[model samples]
Target: MYTEENTARLLPDVAVHAQPHLVGELDWVGMDGIEVPVRFDAGDGDVQRASARVGAFVNLRRPDKRGIHMSRLYLQVEQALSTQTLSTATLRDLLRGFLDSHKDLSDRACLSIRFEHLVRRPALRSANSGWRSYPVTIEASMIGEELLLEFGTEIVYSSTCPASAALSRQLIQDQFAKDFDAGKAVEHAAVLAWLGSEKGIVATPHAQRSVARLRVRPAEGAAFNLIDLIDVTEQALGTPVQTAVKREDEQAFALANGGNLMFCEDAARRIQKALDADKALSDFHIRVEHQESLHPHDAVAYASKGVEGGYAGKGCA
Candidate 1:
């Protein structure tokens, strides 16, 4: 029978501890897509467990070391993340553990976890609610005593084209003028009947499902308030997609869309203004995409807090 002593004699660490043929330092060396169980505070003191895909990395400072302890990284992620609620402090400690394991082999470490955050949303003008899942990514890195944390989430909502609304209003006016002759005194009943008819409202503004990808660098000592950020963004947009709806709720949603006509630029600017006012977020990047109903292409806009050396105001991050 195979025993521990015999197994140890049979397998050696030659390959793992071997020196690299090309002796040059790598910027980062580690593994990704490690399956891990994580928990986070989802507002109101509620702790939620989620399945997360983790990426862990540490700098390869030693030119002679060919490889890192991949198993060590995986174990650290599994043990640390599974036991603690994911937060800035937990992430910082996790990254520090990474560097500690690699010791002289690395000076910096990074960790990322991606998962779906589920929230219960109440229907507009209804006594019902449903669950919505938001894709969220939390990333942390520790480099030379400086720890950075970034939170990213995707928010799905509705966007109505402003230009399309204007054109639709013009068409409706033209239809109304055709029904009633100029300088003719129309009866209230006739006008109301006509307004109720399909021919009366001949056009509608094109609205489509839109997505907002937001990445924010929280201020120092700020807690992970994921739901708060989501609520702020959805409130600013004012047209978040509904989970459950009745006719009344549908009508209310339509009214909201009518009142909140926006282009991609408008969505981005609205989110920018809201994030700028948030004291918890020191820097942020916003990318809003309107999946156009009138055209095959999507309309996109990008914005940032204009923080120096932060977000750079370019991509969605």
Candidate 2:
């Protein structure tokens, strides 16, 4: 049955109301990419609310344009915020409500929570301390008889290239050895001055602020602790942020950084190696983003458990 008059007609001061027209249950429903500030730790009265962009994507399929109610998704997220400590467990409830929200209209649902995780950091070379933010994303889906949980985390650090350092070191040794062969004892300060100056340098390996991110599915369901995963991620990446750093800490950090000099490809390989060794990670995807200081663009490397397109190390290329 098709009627053009019914589609176009709108009442002029007429009291008439009808529910939305539905062909069938939806494949997915609910809102997505909605931004909200989430507060956890129900015990504390003065707990700070962490900012999280929270929303669900439920499975809905409707032949007609008008399908699931849009307001339901907003309400579910609001409900989550008003009551509940937002852990992996709570996200499942929000998804179940998402499906139940539509009743028979939806059979499956998906949800994603995106947030900027903040932690205090002390300056690398100074006493100043401030908060640094890392992008974090968590997503879950209800499909058929199984529920899937996925977690994503990112950490920022710096990388320095070691290959370039080795070549420069060799050049100085050769130059001094030749001078010594001619019965001339070259002053050590002269070698230092030449190498320290830009003239004697061919190309110094540059390090930049880097971001390491990982994605994984939890096998233990909602009870899984994402904090441990976060720690593992930071440890795998090598240069983690420091909260409280005195001069000694700063010196230690500098020593650590110099020792852990890595290229973008090296960082990726290092993470891949770590992932291969870790028992907790069954399936994972890791990406390293190096924000180059020498160049305006970033250098990146990606890796997976199966080693598909993942630059394991600089030797990989």
Task: Tell me the whole-model lDDT of each prediction, alpha carbons only.
Answer: 0.90, 0.67
- Per-residue lDDT over 1-317 for candidate 2, one digit per residue giving the tens place of the 0 to 100 score: 44777654542422122235535545555666677777543222334467787667665554444456667788888778656766666877877877787665567888777776555555656677876665667777876646777777777776776775677667756664654555766678987787676656544556677888777655463343445665566676667766667877778776777788888788888877876776655566777888877779888888777744332342422
Question: Could you tell me the lDDT of residue 216 within candidate 1?
Answer: 94
| Superposition TM-score, candidate 2 onto the true structure | 0.71
TM-score for candidate 1: 0.95
Q: Model 1: clashing residue pairs?
A: none
Candidate 1 lDDT over 142-235, as tens digits, reads 9977999899999999988899999999999999999899898999999999989998889998999999999999999988788999999999
Off by over 4 Å in 1: 1-10, 15-20, 314-317
**Highest lDDT model number:** 1
Instruction: Report lDDT (Cα) of residue 106, candidate 1.
Output: 89
Q: For candidate 2, what is the lDDT?
A: 0.67
Q: Provide the lowest-lDDT 10-residue window in model 1.
A: 12-21
